[model samples]
Target: MTHVSGKRLSVALAVAAVLATACTGGGAAPKDAAGGYSAQPKQTGTPKDGGTATVALTPGLSPNYIYPYPPAAANGTVVARGLLWRSLYRPSGEGDQIADAELSLAEPPAYSPDRKTVTIKMKDYKWSNGSPVTADDVVFSMALLKAALAESPANWSFYTPGQFPDGVTAEAAVPDTLTLRLETAYNPSYLLSMLTLLYVMPSAEWNIARTGGPHLDYKQPKHAKAIYKYLTKESESQSTFASNPLWKVVNGPYLLKSFDSTTGSFSLTPNPAYSGPGESRLDQVDFKAFTSAAAVLNQFKAGNLTVGTLDSSFVSQIAALKAKGYNVYGAPAPARLDSLVINFKNTVNNFDKIITQRYARQALQRLIDQQGYITSRGVYNGAGSPNYSTAGHGSPYPPAFGDRPPYPYDPAAAEKLLTDNGWKVTPNGSTTCERPGTGPGQCGAGIPRGQTISFTLASANAPAFVGARDVAFASAAKKLGIEVKIVTKSLNYMYANYGNTYAPATKNEWAMQDYGPLYLAAGYPSSNTVLNTEGSFNLGSYQNAAIDKLINASTFGSDGKSLSAEVSSLAEDLPVLFLPTPHTLVVWKNTLSGPQSSFNALISFLYTPELWYFHDASGARP
Candidate 1:
């Protein structure tokens, strides 16, 4: 998943614009004259065969784990996995499709009439060791994946109790064909979306539990568990990443040439025996890591970096980079939503009861000034769009309240709603519940009179926007006498130690949290393991029977419209306080040329650097 940033329910707030422009050097970016920022660079020339490209890893999100399916504590950072081991189906950069047919290792799956079994035909691909990549490898990967999930749902974010690897069985019945038998039927579209995340590893080379040990059948449950344990342990030794024989075996375009445990930087070289779509033209890729975005901007200024993303806070530097011979383009991170996730289990100040009330939730949502947040120079700097639904902006499955929020930002309305619901509205003072009962106009059940709307908000320190927006939210809430106490924490710390289910002891410590963005699969964007009642990633215990039913319908039913209904319901429900969706500004050297599809930022941050090449004096177009 990708982590990536509304408010008045209207009014183009002129002062915010003035302040935004003043902070950003007056012009956020130069006009395209030709249209706007294009994902693909417009270069006219042949690409040079050998040259190293220095890429910048997202600030605070460097590759700490080389293995696919990292533990929950890893904070879901994946930059090297795609380059080392390709998934069975390559993600189609386009929003219209789930997987790219031409680049996939396997052909489009054929489903049985009963829609319970799927047969997959593998393409001719080979591992770095020159061995043919077969369906056996796919089965091996699935086996290890199930083993990982069996250990803990926190092992994989996409995991749900009875989903994907749970009741499904895989078999490689033929040399190049793999068949899967499912215990239950699922929507084909949703199933295809899940498959895009399944990366294939070499079974013959990586089927051992220890170094110099004999290989075992990965299909066996016990053996698979041992193998998974071994690989995960090996992955922990970051210092030996380049020397590890287990990490060297790959079917994708590049190989791990070296890794820097100290700085989290690494380099990749083309695998000589790789059998994939791209030319693998670049001689090497140096993924540089940084502690902050400002350092990356400095590297760009010095021409020390070739490819990287510009933080929203640094959008003002776009024109300066363009002058330095760079192609800069940006779009909202695809299938991503940034929100202030509420901890429904937090009993502090009776927050659970207050938040559980639909009116209370609506009042809290209205207090958020989305427009003001995005327009703030310290925040998104006009690099984001207002999104009220989990479906995000430009989603194929849009809520009924298209563009307009169900509860718009109006402090007066927010105060009125609270007052109507047994609250005594005291501007800039503690507003307490005057009436407490299950009846209408009363602060729902379990809430007692004199209960105040005060809760602690845990905010992530990275991304800048999370803290900026939280401060803005707290400020807005103060006007309505809703006390919002914010506590800042590192992203990794929050990911590892701040969940209701995973960290029950601290469940009451945080009433709400803003941990940047959560990315879903590219095309489908299912909320299955995220919003579901039993979802492992459901940080807060938000259990709604109606939402559960809607999720099930979208997940299992044949009708795709159910997703729209589900998202619309979620938008109105305010499970989490929706924030503005921010754009991920991708910047690369002008000399780099590749297919336009390679740079699709929307599709799970898709980037095919293997297909890119330098088109300079030595390698000019014909």
Candidate 2:
């Protein structure tokens, strides 16, 4: 799963800006530049090879686990992991095109005619420990993942039962070649897309057999549990980051040199034995942690940090940063969307009865002023328009959002829909079901007469923008006779309390949730883990039999039409009220240069840091 940062401040400032304009009925405000930022800073001479670059991390947030298997891994961990390890493919290109996967550790895979077998040719790379990376390491890594999945199937939602490693057999016919023969034919491209997230670990150091047996027996639940516990515990401790013998082996650009657990800060030195492409031009890289977005800006302003991400909350400050000679680049909004997920199974306060109605959901969608919320939240200038589909605007399948025009901000339409559904509107816009029945103009089954349209919306307390949006949304809902109560909590708390696997009793507490820009891996853009009935990320436990069939078809279907049709259906269903995709702003010292592409939207500015380097004061590479 892609990491989501919960460090943005409230959008009070944005809301104030919008209120001020509306109160005065002022003309359009001056528009900032709309295009995205460049991938690298301007350079005059050859690239320098030895300067240290300091990057900024979110305040109060640090890498909790260096390993990638756990869903709780933070953005800092994702960025750092890229430096320590190499996947089979990496994100390439820019803007929406950045989702393209480029070969990294191996050549393009060769598939058999039936597409059941895929043969991958390994690159002649060596780990930092001087051991040659071979086919056996890849097979062993898969075995470890399988064992980990056995303990927690949700860890790898892409793994189908009796597929891939279960029915498939991996054979290292030669030191460089690994062949995977599957029992059933699968989409070769989709399989490769899934591999983009599979980090190939050196088996000699990660194997469970080193502790007891020759290899982990994934069939044994105890062995799987033991391996997961040991690996997770080892990776969670900051002390093990630099000292753990298991972590010393690597094949990427850098190795952890030091870590400060107290400050959530760490430094990496170039790996001398690294055999991957784009060698580290800088001798050392330091990740500095801040306490807030303001602190991060202050550090960048004071010339203390070389690379940093400018939060959207500080869009107004971009001009000032550029005036001070910082190179500001706007990354394409990640292929993620922040949404309001309505829990269909919520038994709390009989909200499920109201939420289960298609008219109610449709009315709520129309009641949302997406553009107003974007402007009031200070995200309009940097984000794309409101999305209607589950997949982002940049997803591979172009969604033909069925014949309906984008849900307009029409409170009248919302009111009409509620009234037609037997909701009695009050002068203040509060509503109650007047004619509860089992027919038209009546509330659905289980809904009683006089049931008020009310529910609590839980949103992240940080990233103040979301809070502002929630306020705006609540205000609008008031006009539609809907009572919306807003509750703000930390992102961690929100996920733990209302996440996909949360207990039904606990998950039903909140009627709706506003979080995310939930990122999906590059090339694998299907919403199986989000909208499917058994989706691991289905926080709302929404189940539609038709949707379930479509999701399954999209996942296994080889043709693009089937996937497009699924996206279209999701758009029509509106499982979650879609929000705009915000642009990711990357701010850096004018002297540093590097590849700025990112596969995940949440951490778009921190991608491919190994290629980042510094030039001398004369605008020339030293």
Q: After superposition, how far is residue 105 of candidate 1 from its true place, in Å?
A: 1.4
Instruction: Summing lDDT over every window of 10 consecutive residues in candidate 1, give the lowest-scoring window.
Output: 5-14
Runs in model 1 lying further than 4 Å from the true structure: 1-40, 73-79, 617-622
Q: Give me the overall lDDT of model 1.
A: 0.78
TM-scores of all predicted structures: 0.92, 0.87
The positional error of residue 67 in candidate 2, measured at the CA in angstroms, is 2.6
> Top lDDT: which candidate number?
1
Worst 10 residues of 2 by lDDT: 6-15
Best by TM-score: 1
**How many clashes does each candidate structure show, in the order listed?**
11, 9
Runs of candidate 2 with Cα error greater than 4 angstroms are: 1-45, 71-79, 93-103, 157-168, 208-226, 377-384, 402-405, 427-429, 503-505, 595-606, 617-622
> What's the distance in Å from true for residue 219, model 2?
10
